[model samples]
Target: MAIAGALIWAAVIGTLIYATRERRRVQSEHAAGLLILWGGAIIPALLLGLLLGYALWLMPDIRPWSAPGEPAGLRIEVEGEQFWWRVRYHPADGPPVDAANEIRLPVGERVEFTLTSSDVIHSFWIPVLGGKMDMIPGRTNRLTLRAAKTGTYRGPCTEFCGTSHALMAFSVVVMEPDAFRDWLADEARPSPGAGAPGGELFIANGCPACHTVRGTEATGAVGPDLSHVGSRETLAAGIMPVDVEAIASFISKPDAIKPGAQMPAFGMLPEADIAAIAAYLEGLK
Candidate 1:
């Protein structure tokens, strides 16, 4: 795609350059003949037509979302929320695992990403990967990605969906097959109960009303899952690092850290209570 786009821009610029030169030059009768017209116009027309045709023909092979035996591979459902991402990993032989903000994938595996949106239109894009796909409400878009190397990559929303669009980002980690399998198993397992007021704080704060924490009483349907919040690489959809300080700042003044965030600030709480809440959330990993 990059090569094709560069070629197209070059053709346009070249046309403008030739036109400028013609305008400044002394035109003879021979310069305006049928042969000059053919060389200057018809030849370029035919070349552009062939170039576009070739690009179209290569599209199927470049992004084959429906490759054979794709069903046997890993399936992940990602929902673009107000300003975050809710991810579900479905392994080949186990129940789905819930996660948010961060994603993990195996190196050299063609994982099928089933994308959707909870509200408005969004776009999923990973620059190092292939292309971006639309995330439409009530509809699913599919994209396949196979990493050629093991590393961490960032993915940002290519579409402007809302006020906090700038902060709506996620991270992807590509690991070796064995490492990924182990991580997947660990992530898929249910989270252990945090016990006591730590659990109480999550509930008394009305967290369960919007988030879900496995192996606990907190079950909220409106926000992203908090079953493994501490394990994520970043918080507030990559706006801040996943640390106690960041979590505390987010809990106190969410919109300050991330403008236009949907989560309200907790400045009304005492400092000690806020620290306890942040500690509890950061200990989930």
Candidate 2:
């Protein structure tokens, strides 16, 4: 397209120079009318029409949505929150698995995603894998993606939904099919560290009212699931490292790290209790 535009510009300049140099000649009106009919209208119309057609031809490959009536074996539903992502995997042969902040996919397999927003508008975009799709409240959108290679990539909320929109992000881990299967199987199970001393403190501190740790008494659904938080690569929607200190710090004061976080600060808790809780969470894997 750039080359075509450059060629057209050169032709216009050449025509103008020729016309200026031949100003002494009395050109017929028929010649000017012909130039206007072809150069001004027909040529541009043809060029733009060809470009439009080429773009339309590439549309399917660019926005690779699932075809009608196609059977999608795996479906992932991602809900955009204020500053986090709620991910759920629905496998064809098993029950749905709930996760948060991170997405794991099998390379070479096409996966369809159902995206929506819980509060304001947000856009789901994994630039390495596919284009962005809007996630709006009370509306659902679908996008399909297939990773050709195994690697880790980052996805962000492209739309400005709230004060902490810049802090909202997620991780995409593409793995071999077998590895993805194994990982998903393990993710389906409950948290292994659900019986630790910190788990008791977590429940006692009213953490269960918002978060859920499978296999434990914490069954709240208002926030991200902590079933395998320690196993994930990052914390707080990929803003912090997944470690005891980060967890403790986030728990103590979420707003300090994420300005518009919905999770209230637990700074009043004893330092020892906070450390114990963070340790328990770190052992969730």
Candidate 3:
């Protein structure tokens, strides 16, 4: 179309020049006719450009992998925090798996995400696959995305949450349906008990003031609900991994892992206590 438009424009210009050269007796009329012709052509092109731009702006995001019905495979809760993201995968047929920094979705299946925040406002965005949705405290926002291709996509917090906001990022892994099911099954199995010291320290110290565990007495909601913390992929709001060592270090000093994080450091605890806490959290998966 652009090539055709260029050719037509060239023809119009050539016609104007030819009329100017051939019609000396009616030069004024020829010039007026040329002006009118050019004006008429230019107006429509400008209007078409404007319309196309407007359409692009107003178009809803297109995710090629999404099936055209309610998502049937998985529902994940993504909570944005200052400088990080918390990911929770709720299996359609099994229990939820909690993690930080990473999200997994089944290829060719629709996945729904419910976004929320623990503190200030944030926006969730995955550019290649979906649109941005705000995560406001005390309220939930919904976003749906599907990965037509089996590869990793990077996502970040489009809304500035805090100082370390630039570090707020996560990855979505789109895998085959069977592989995703296997991963969920593995995450569901309980971890062996080896984190008793950490569990005891979690209670002895004041970590339960702002977190929660569904089956336990620690039921605080001021922070990200930690009922399934061990199963999560990231922590400190997608700022760090949810592994035993990372959990231990984060509990020892959250500020070190995520600057300006609201969680206070518990480095004063003995190494054994921190390890125990990390072990217990790892078992939550």
Best by TM-score: 2
| Tens-digit lDDT track of model 3 for 1-285 | 587578768977996787678545755788777777766677668768876987676444333234479456678898887766677888877777765566778898778889899889998888877778999999988777767888777788888778878778877778899998887676554333323335666766777787765545565755666655666556655566778898889888888777897888988888987888887877776
Steric clash pairs (candidate 1): none
Q: Per-residue lDDT tens digits of candidate 2, residues 1-285?
A: 799889989999998898889468777999989999999999989989999999999677545466799775688999999899999999988999999999999999988889999899999999999789999999989888888999999999999998999999999999999999999999999876778777889999999999999998788989999999999989999899999999999999999999988999999999999999999999999
Ranking by lDDT: 2, 1, 3
For each of the candidates, the C-alpha root-mean-square deviation to the true structure, in angstroms, is 3.6, 3.8, 6.8
Clashing residue pairs, backbone N/CA/C < 3 A, model 2: none
Q: Model 1: how far is 250 from its true place, Å? A: 0.6
TM-score of 3: 0.64
Residue 67 in candidate 1 has what lDDT?
Answer: 55
For candidate 3, the lDDT comes to 0.73
| Per-prediction tally of clashes | 0, 0, 14
